[model samples]
Target: METILNVEGMTCGHCKAAVESAAKEVSGVTDAAVNLELGNVIVTHDDALNIGEVKQSIEDQGYDVK
Candidate 1:
C-alpha cells in the first residue's frame, strides 16, 4: 500500500530527508519519498502499513501533515 501526505515546512534536502527517514522507521514501511517543492511525501509499504504511525513518525521529525 501507499499513501501521499501533504507535508509542510520542508524547504531543503535535509528537511526532506528527515521526513523520509522518519516515515521509513514505521515497521511496515518499505520506502519513503519527499517532494520539497510540492510539500508532500509518498510512503510505500506492505499491505498492512500503519498510516497513523507513519504520519506520526513524520510529525515527530517536526513536519506537519495535510
Candidate 2:
C-alpha cells in the first residue's frame, strides 16, 4: 500500500531528509520519499500500517502532516 501525505514547512534538503527518516521509522513502512517541490511525502508500506501512525511519525519530526 502507498500513502501520500502533504507536509508543511519543508523548505530544503534537510527538511526532506527529516520527514523521510521519520516516516521510515514507522513500523511496517517499507520506503519513504519526499518531494520538496511539492511538499509531499509518499510512503510505501503494508496493510498492517495505520495511516494515523504514519502521520504522527512525520508530525513528530516537527512537520505538519495533512
lDDT of 1 by residue, 1-66 (tens): 778999989999999889989998889999998988888998998987769998898888888887
Residue 64 of model 1, lDDT score: 87
Which lDDT values do the candidates have, in the order given? 0.90, 0.92
- Writing each residue's lDDT as its tens digit, candidate 2 over 1-66 gives 998999999999999999999998889999999999898999999998998998998898899998
Q: Per model, state how many residue pairs clash.
A: 0, 0
Q: Model 2: which ten-residue window has the lowest total lDDT?
A: 57-66
| Model 2: CA > 4 A from native | none
* Candidate 1 residue pairs that clash: none
**What is the lDDT for 31 in model 2?**
98
